[model samples]
Target: MTEKMLQQYKVWDAPTRIFHWVNFTTVILLLLVGTLMYFKKDLGITGLEAKIAIKEIHVWIGYVFAINLSIRLLWGFIGNQYARWSNILPGKSFPAVLSSYIASIKSGEPQQFLGHNPLGRLAVTLMMLILITLAITGLVRAGTDIYYPPLGASFAAHIAAEGVDPASIKPYDKTGTNPEAYQELKAFKGPFGDIHIYVAYTLLAIILLHIIAVVRAEITEGGGLVSAMFSGRKTLAKKPEDLN
Candidate 1:
């Protein structure tokens, strides 16, 4: 009987690993805080102060989420070969590549890659789009709903009463705000809130599927995927399909 020969590969870099863990932690916290806010009334939580406090916490977590996402996005442009957008994104040859990968999977000898496999690339692309949507919509809600920064002052100034300072406008308070303009601002922000929440629901499903896929790949492919994110290395028995 022949013994299996395994090879270790350097995969994830330090910045990539840091971004992954930070993004994961922030996403979990945002989900929990968002759930509390969504079901605050059902949980017997009441009063304006309590409601705003929860929202504040959620927004703070979202800030962390947004910053982490931004760093990762920027890193994709300048990071290592495995971390670059060229590796993560599907290109003109992606269809053929994906077909080949699927065929390999069916043959009982799944092809392995140091970076994302074709299917994994598709999943990551979809998730990145969803996350960017979440960040934009969340920021819009933060500004329109709570007078937070970036777009807050503009929205506040737009709705403020004549002779009133935009900075003096308190969230949820009608004073120092023109009624008609306030209503208009509310209408404008409504769709963003709707999209933010529904997309968040979709994200939950994707996250579940992502975890399942990772676990399945780890078991069937013997890549040490979970550990690789921490230790920045992958051990595989065969030569990786994406090895360069």
Candidate 2:
């Protein structure tokens, strides 16, 4: 075979590549919005209007994040081995692999794999669960209020007035008229709001660690691990004996 033909290999499928980048972008955006919401008080931004505007952006972006996560999860099951949930979780042979990895570490030798190693798999799984929880909590907090307001002048008029009398009333106008409903909305949002902030911080730490691990692998392994992830090709062994 020609050198180019011998070098041809496929690693990440198209769907997996798309999912990886999409999740990366959404995670970064979510972190930014979360930070703004968490530190809004300390930032000393004046007026309820500004605060509400920030929150609206945060909540809507959260909805988009949730949708992206759901699509990724579905793709994981239907995608390639590397992207599958089963690949991340330890299987029946995990004990032997774990032992080999531990022994290699103690002997100052490197363990290699085409897919995520044990520790990397664990981190990926944990990050996915945390993200899913954050998305669900955000949806639960927002969907209820957006679809059905508990108090205020009544979304009833806003719903009817949308096309009939656009200038007649506003959504917040209804909230202003119903103090009790507004308090109920606040009660639902407060606790989950705190949970979301803490989860975001945890995810940030995990992301930093993940990047560090990738950098270390690229430096030590000489295998172009990072580029392999994007290009779906790695340096092949020179001989069958070099295979591990």
Candidate 3:
């Protein structure tokens, strides 16, 4: 093979790699803490203590994820062409690109790209929305009763919908118990909390599928799919015709 033809490809920006791993670790940690809280198991403390600590950790991680997501969203607007949101959702071109990818996969031929493919882009977008909702709900739940008293009362009913009894906790007096506000908050909070949990589970499933797809591509396409995210290099085909 000619030297030029045998050369490998380089892709994936350093910032993107860092974001990927950081988000991965944060999600895993959140899952662990969430599981403990949902099950009400005494992970390492008494019943009440364990519940309190797990909830605290969950809230803190929610904040961390939210900040990281905001940074990523900003980066998407200003980053390289491959990283830009426009590249992923380029008007009507998105559907065509997505169809091409599906066709390539079915033909046992994977198309190489410098950045996320159409389906990948869509998945990332959905994941971001889900994470945002998760963070906002968690913040409202936390601030409602534990950290800030006045604000907590406003969202008391909403907080309770997430399986937390805002009234049971005596952190503040019932000085401004507006039943209407309480009921309104509760009505929204309850259904939103359930939706949040279900979406989290869906996110986990998507993550697993993403990992599997990467592994499959690496094996079949003879490309360093995983390492490319880390070291940003792909093995080149022996000849131009080999691209097929």
Candidate 4:
């Protein structure tokens, strides 16, 4: 067997690498806490205090995730060449990239990518959009249910305008003047929570598949997608023009 000679390239920049791992870690935490919050009753998590404590952690972590996602979305515009939005969105070369990937899969040959390959690029784009939806829905749900912040009080105002007296409503898990009003608030906030939970689950499934595909690429394509996110470098073939 012949050894493959590779040229080192600085593909992932420092900011991009940090954003990737922090987002990954935060998402995992969100999933765990979210599950606990969703099933705290069935999980034998008794008392309103215990549930509120769990909700507090989940809500704050969700805020951090939303902020992190915002920075990433902005960085996609101002970041390095490899991290640019244009690089990930289907550009003029995407068709060729996809065709090449398919060919490599069937022929057992490795294809090089200076940045995200076509399939990976598509996955990342979809994940980002989904993350934004989850974040927005989470905010509305938190506001309506617990009056957290940002949009929380705003949602409260809306419900208050609906003939439910403001003084009658209390944040969930707390004694309020009117239990019926709080139930109304919960019903108003229901759709946002539903969407957030559903989209979050979808994102989890996508993350698992993303991990699988990246691992497959690491073994077959020899691109350091995972390691490169940590070290900010990758190995690719030197072009013939550069060899001159």
Better of 2 and 3 by TM-score: 3
Candidate whose TM-score is highest: 1
Per-residue alpha-carbon lDDT of candidate 3 for residues 65-164, written as tens digits (9 for 90 to 100): 7678778778888876666777765477677777887887789776655566556678777777777777666666666535433255555554343455
Q: What's the candidate order when arranged by decreasing lDDT?
A: 1, 4, 3, 2
lDDT-better candidate, 2 vs 4: 4
Task: List where candidate 2 sits over 4 angstroms from the true fold.
Answer: 1-9, 144-185, 236-244
Candidate that scores best on lDDT: 1
Compute each candidate's TM-score over C-alphas: 0.98, 0.76, 0.77, 0.87
lDDT of each: 0.93, 0.66, 0.67, 0.79
Lowest lDDT 10-residue stretch of candidate 4:
235-244
lDDT per residue for candidate 2 within 150-205, as digits (tens), equals: 22224333333234442343434452234564456557667876787788889899
- What is the Å distance of residue 190 in model 4 from its true position? 1.6
lDDT of 2 at 105: 54
RMSD in angstroms, all models? 0.7, 6.0, 5.6, 3.4
Q: Residue by residue across 72-119, what tens digits does model 1's lDDT show? A: 999999999999999989999999999998998899899988999898
How far residue 51's Cα lies from its native spot in candidate 3, in Å, is 1.6
Q: After superposition, how far is residue 50 of candidate 3 from its true place, in Å?
A: 2.8
